[model samples]
Target: MKVKGYPMLASLLAVMLLVGLQTPAYGENATTRATWIWQTDLIKDGGEELLHFASDEGITLIYLQIDRQLPPEIYEAFIKRAHENQIAVHALGGDPRWALTEHREDMLGLADWVLNYNGKVSTGARFDGIHLDIEPYVLAQWEDETDEVISTWEQNLIMFLNQASGSDLELGIDIPFWFDRYTLGNGTSLNEWLIGTFDQVTVMAYRNQVESENGILDLTRDELELANRLGKQILIGVNTKEMPREPHTTFYGYGKESLNAKMEHLSSALGSYASFAGIAIHDIRNWQNMSSDVTVPPDEEEPTTPPPDPDPDPNPEPGEGDRVPDADPITRDPVVRGTYIWEAHEVIRNSQEILDFAKEKNLNWLYVRLDLEQPYTKYSSFVKQAAAAGIEVHALGGHPIWALEENRPRMMRLVNYVKNYNRAVEGDERFHGIHLDIEPYVLPAWRENSQQVISEWTANLDAFVTELKKDSNLEASMDMAVWLDKYKVTGQDMSLSKWMINRMDHVSLMAFRDKAEGSNGIIAVAKEEIAFADELGKPIKISVEIKASHEGDHITFYEEGAAYMEEELAKLPELLKDSPSFTGSLVHAYAYWKNAKP
Candidate 1:
């Protein structure tokens, strides 16, 4: 959390009254007071005592550190206890370094860890929400590469929110109170965008007084007003923990009596705002020990360096410096906003719903499968309808061992079907491309005959791409797991993932992780793939799943519902803003996406 600025006086009578005042309950008329439970307090076996203190103090929320080192049962019991007392327990942990690309996967790992835990824990015992404390301004590079670092900060933030959106988790971020002073090159004010993006925001309004220019309410006024207008919640945070410099930074110097007085004044002054959720004390342990005799150091000096230039050219052409200077962008902007359609025939009957969905979601591409059992006329009509709706239809089909000579005909059949459809139809009614989803990993031969099967799988993909290009004028693409880059064919040194991307006009990464953030999740898995595609100048779509799966909860958002899935997908374009080859995204299939329960 970020802190800036300070305040003045309180009478002994007000201090005495403040100390005796009870912590308000959590409700609209009452302040929803919360506090951070540092990891240290949690490590000690004080769960019962912690709840007692919070309940007595009227803490409605406790941002608990996600300590995997502690037993799962510990958190379960603690959360169970907290919930019983009406205090929401949110998983909280983050570091400034997470803004770096290399460290982002680990940062996202925190969310995945929480999600995985929630999957196994009982619903009631699970975390009520996720509260991230990622303060990117603390990084050393932030001073020199302010624009780049802050952009990375927002990227990571959006990714984390995307992951949290996969569950029913209410997400909150801790931002410095002064974020309004910082603006992005895109004209987005940090505080405004942050508050607007999340479910709620807790400003680090860590001053000790109530009414002067640097007072608690004064510092938090901007956020409270903005949140009210946006219908988002804002929590005015205060400091209790003692720091090295500026004793005014915490209440330790003046004691709990003074602190309570200031908090009371803050609540009274800011409580009228609809967005003013409540006050959140910096921590629990420090509040418990208000007897430190720490001396005040001289006022800390502010950095002399000015912040990065906020207004960069917003209309640079493609292949210019819009992205990192390391790679050049494609001549044409990417056009891969797509979804797979397994029930190609059913689409004809449900053409309007499909068209409406495509138009509403800005989906421009469709990967429709060949249902041989359905009439050829049905496929043609659906393709025509899709074209009319401004959706480019890509003929989709695949089978394992497609690289083998014996199975090569199966792949050819799909290519031929699309060719025939194109030959029969004129202009816009014809298929725009062919998309293959052959996965050799699922084949029985993969395990029974490892080397040969692996070798054959790569060979088949190579053959298919080579043959498809020669036989069809339509654009060709294929889907593969993100880890294909890490895998090498039995006798070959080349990466399967890279090889596939290089050979195709486009590649869709079956980035399948339900959570969009984190290392093992969607964004991290696709990071390398996107970079490689950027280098190769091929367009790519990072696909996600909404369908139910026998696979683990971490792999699909079946339980998260459609609204949440949409929220997560909306974060993608911004998250991948720097990747020139990022064409957009692809939902796994039309049938599943439409039917997924909200």
Candidate 2:
């Protein structure tokens, strides 16, 4: 549902005339409260719990994401119960890819399923409407082919409308508030056009504050005015889910009381308008778990004042517990032609083959996965061999859960294992560094409580470095996603990318796009990270994807072949000549690249 960047406008007057619409049955003077149920399995698995939560939250409308695989009877049973509780259910389904012509069938299929299911269901079980949450801006094409993307997106919506013609079901769409900034070819704002085209338009006016510049009210004002002028319902959508990257967009840490107060204020300010359909929280799961008080638990809600910040931990002296005297600082070539070795056991079984491949590829560094269960001699022999061949080998291991406080020991164990191994080895046989591949965003808790995950991830990094620097001069490096620049450290003005670059000896940005250049390519996405690293005088390597990805053909060099990948990668040196921090590039792994067509 989150789309990046700004958009242009469009006019939908002609389209509206072509397809007549019916307004949903919102009782006279009754404020329509709604929530999204994105997890469709809940309909069959936890129907009672879901219905009870909806009734308690006073949610009048539920936007249930359609799961076509589920039995039609499950939908009927759930919708019937929801109807009994006076809650109307609307089928919801969409993807950013739906904006493309080839993906139109997926969009139309949702509509056909809903209409077909409605025909066989009882009145109470019938879906009241269809809600589309397609966010085309998330597409790679949105950056370079804005016009074409918008045109296709509009065409897809028209196709959807044409498919739904003659149906009683109302149509609605979720759009960001900034759609008004995008002026369509016909000179109408996209927001206004959408408001005119659909039976209802839910403006994602997601902000913790309801007033002030860039707040919910300011962002939604134009859409509200347009909705009023067009005499269409405009449901203001607020977010309860955690958004660590854009913290101000959600009322996650603000508590339920604050959310209710802000919604009350919003209602007071815009309730007079006929088009004001009322507030819609982004979802039900998070809203249900939102605390009544910001800082205090529901059971212990007496505290009114915020807790004071804790004192910072002082730096520990070297040679403390499990710490040895610091080893002399090691230096290496600034250039980083690296690749990952995920199967460490391969090094033991095929040392010569791995070395021959690395040499052939001219790789200078290897992030070799450390198998702690194996004897020390297994890694020692490979590290010594790699070092003699002028290749730096670093230990690599991580998991998503390693980002949480409860899982700190698991992460520390890896750090300690490497540190202890270094203490017992000769300089040439020792690991050059530790390369972490922790992708905390993959954790389910990351979506539910992102701020907490970020905090714990940061703490784990601190523990990692502290343990790493205890007795060795090992370099600290990690693989990070390119988009992490969007997130700021909770209390810091700097971005997460900058913070990591400043802390680590060097970092590898997973700029997975196949192309080295162009708006949606690797260079464009890694630009910010490279700049940040340059500012901090740190080194950064742009990592490319070779492993076949289902995401899209543009995501990997799999189909392009190794020869073509090298040809594209050959463009980086000249293009990034000015960036001293641009050390070099790294292919995702040895396994995929080894067998990749030449």
Candidate 3:
């Protein structure tokens, strides 16, 4: 059925369902696609006009997918038209299953040809980068092929980028937005592998879009907030045309007006914290020549629940040059467990000390902060040693650069660098996952005001994690909040921890900052976070503040508190569920872990 003929309500729902990576909603401001595209996939005629319009409208990027190999002449003409119009061009993926599964060498070679075509089109063409929309495991490849896919992506793509690094070419990879947060069939440890490798990363964040029936802005806000937070140079996607996703016609795409409105709202919400470097328009096919008059309304409260994210990472290729040491392959303890501080960075500034501490106390995992300036060796070595001693390592990330509020493109470089270093230098067995410590407070002041800024922040985070997983065998876990269970923290305006964690291997809750009197004790609160994870069947972990985080105002839970908690923890197994369900406990800091024990 045509979109205009669909029930107004249904069409509205379709137009706004998953606008900002969160949910379907009313007339709230929409997030715009920064990198707009003239997708060849299922696109109608006059696709060039959409590219022209995007360029005229000052959109930053455009992508065109090639169905099968094209003749050089046809490819050159397409490239020339885009360049003549001054639009940036990138590739979109839709390889036939046969090419993807059986004709592996040919498929990657085709990608290389396209990549070369993109290069030959212009300097870097309109934008200085290349994009791959490899939807992994949509169906199975041979077990051997799984590793081959990643190996080829890295060897070919990274090699290409390195060759052009001196020439000023930019490169990036695109993946399903939910990969980092959700466990899915075709995911990869891409961010980790490509860190230091790619120029930027984009995440696709739209599906089932719709405006609220009441025309209120509740649900849309949540999604936009999520998209803004999840990826680097995130380019959260929103479809320009109104159409139903196949099979069910269940999910609808976004309209131009709604998307623009969402972008404006996101800009307002994120302010300077708004790292939304830009938006990714799904297709120019749907974008009409004229702009829409859709006005984003103010946001309202969202639904009590949200749609689920894929719930659940990577490893090595067989090689004579080196055989990866076999690992026992320990799954995360079902009980809520989390570690802080590792994922990016080169050296664990204080390693030997931290590992001894984690091992002695029986902690399940350790979050290691490897300073990016240092080579990966110091950090990678520490993780191997720690894992050998029966403790897991989780790489932690904090910005090495002081300017956190830089443009999306710039920040993406930092994220990619960190993730790439982790994968290239570290081992799959030594670490359980990459842990994102996305403390938004440090963002440039301009970003502090807008919630969309936070969404952008998250998108960048997700991009790094997703990309890394493409190359490695680890899972993706992020540190979220303890506040999600009950009360909302006023003015903070970040994605709800639950909302963000919906796509994670499990969420790690930093459950502290006691303000009100008579609140549940820290362990009680931690348990609450775990319970929620259990309810969702998503694994959960807690960062127990064995010591007070700061000496100031918040309740100080130092050694005395740690001991009290440690004693309580000794009895924790007796309180309820299976031992595995509890995972393991994470204490705050090398300083604190040094002192506490069960």
Candidate 4:
């Protein structure tokens, strides 16, 4: 034992044997933090920013978009740079439509591109894997002809899997968390088949919260177990893009600190299982914006499967206002108080009366349109008085056509005009936010071709937000109908309500019902929207109609006296005490309500 170099020689041999026998740990806490990067981001000078952002987020792998047009040298440089930082890059590209026979060659083209790139680059610059995000569910046939489409999807998947298996490259696929709900013709669940078929699979479990029935953990639990059984690893993805409204499904609303906390919770729940890899934030840009410190914990030896559903009812006995939390409790004071102020001229002339009425009613916000033609001095004076009375003013004026491409600039001009005035005016005198009342469904074209019109409308709004966000950071809100959740968009497969809510900072739901009680009343109509808003942590301002309507008794409070309205509104706080984002109630218009007869 005390011999000259014997101990040193034995230690060197042991180290060599350990190194030779050791295999990659595809187990719990042996996680890889991954992010997606669009092709445009990777080819431009901005690519460096992406790399820097990834490094900051502690990203171990990047699924970079494959750009065949990009020069080989650029790809090599990016891959080399990533590798130097100990990051693996996977060439990513795919389209759900490509699942068709006509697009089969193009789908294969992605693999060919990766193979070609790998051959061209040095060993250090080569891609570590390939990731395809071909979502076939959005296709029209998927809904109308499900069996055929599923078959086609299966065929294309098999072909792609075969090609990957034949090649030297490692392959991964992005799948919706609901894949477990679908079964293949062979009787295996789609998720199980996928985990069995690929080197890796990423579940798009994109909700911000990690708890709850549909949260990331619950959605991915099955896949995590299956992947472990199959001796594979899976990444759970979360979204970061800003949504139009709340039951916000992305981390954009959670902020960095909360996201970090939620990720820790996710790890705590899943890290004990074998095959429980780390979280993968959706795209690089959003992850960069998030800026969370990702820390991996020490691994533990455990079974691969998830623990049986944590006692289906965590609490068997019901308690007052007791329910399982969808997310961490974020408290906000109950707000249900405001009214619309129509007629710009009347508001300016009767400013004192409006202020007094608002104070008497304990209103906190006023939705009104601005008359820029009026003297700025007079306008500022009224707004200042309103603020002194503890009332926030939100400018409201938008036509359905404003959401069309041709009229978008005009709408933008209006937004810019408000921002310019705000910059010039004192804080209290300026409008708090812009409320766009552009109801796309009210347009004639929408009635005839709802899908196309709605698509165009949503795209227009997205473009407007893109431009508005570029120049102005003012709060922007939109008006929406409660029924919007019923209609689904063709290409997106999501409800119109969901699409719109994801685009706005917040939404004012037109829960215009005369009665506050009963099944067909204000609360019933607004229940769904309010629940959604609560989930997303987005505030919702429910509006009731006092103005006489051409519709019917059910939609307007015209005949219901002001006293009845107050009585009904009083019931909201108790009714909505459980909702995290029940901002409060708003009356339709001041002019109508001020003059309404009992």
State which candidate has the highest lDDT: 2
Tell me how far candidate 3 lies from the true structure as C-alpha RMSD in angstroms: 22.8
Candidate 2 lDDT over 1-598, as tens digits, reads: 1111211112233444333224442324547899998878777864999899889878899999998999999999999999999999899998999989999999999999999999998898899999999988756576558778777887788778777866788789999988877755666667776788788889998876666556777788888777766767889999986543234567655568777877888877776666788889988877887767643112111111212211322212212331213422323334778899887668988999999999999988899887676678788988999999999999887765567776688678788888888888888999989988877664445556667788888888888888889878998999988877666666665566777877788899988888988878888878777777766667888889887775678888988889999998889988888887887889987878886767
TM-score of each: 0.45, 0.56, 0.38, 0.52
TM-score of 3: 0.38
Error of 3 at 285 (Å): 48
RMSD of each: 23.0, 13.2, 22.8, 21.0
Candidate 3 residue-wise lDDT, 116-139, digit = tens: 665555442333445655565443
lDDT of each: 0.70, 0.77, 0.46, 0.69
The backbone clash count of each candidate, in order, is: 2, 6, 102, 12
Superior by TM-score: candidate 1 or candidate 4:
4
Better of 1 and 3 by TM-score: 1
Distance from true location, Cα of 496 in model 4, Å: 25
Candidate 1 lDDT over residue span 1-598, tens digit each? 1211111111321332242233232225645788998654453574888889898888899999877677787888888888889989888888888877778887788889889889998977999888988887756476458789877887777667556654777778899988898876577798887877777689997765566556666677788778766667778788875331233456543456556666776677765777777888988877876533222211222111212212322212223322333434476565557788776445766777888888877888888777654556777777777877778888887654354445666677777677777788767678878888765553334445646766766676677667767755888788877766655556655556666777788888988777777656677767777877887777888888876664567667777877877787777777888888888788877766765666
- Highest TM-score against the true fold, candidate: 2
Instruction: Give the per-residue Cα lDDT of candidate 3 at 3.
Output: 22
Query: For residues 30-142, what per-residue lDDT tens digits would candidate 4 score against the true structure?
Result: 55889888645445663677788778768899888877887878888888888988899898888888777778888888887787777776899898999989888766456
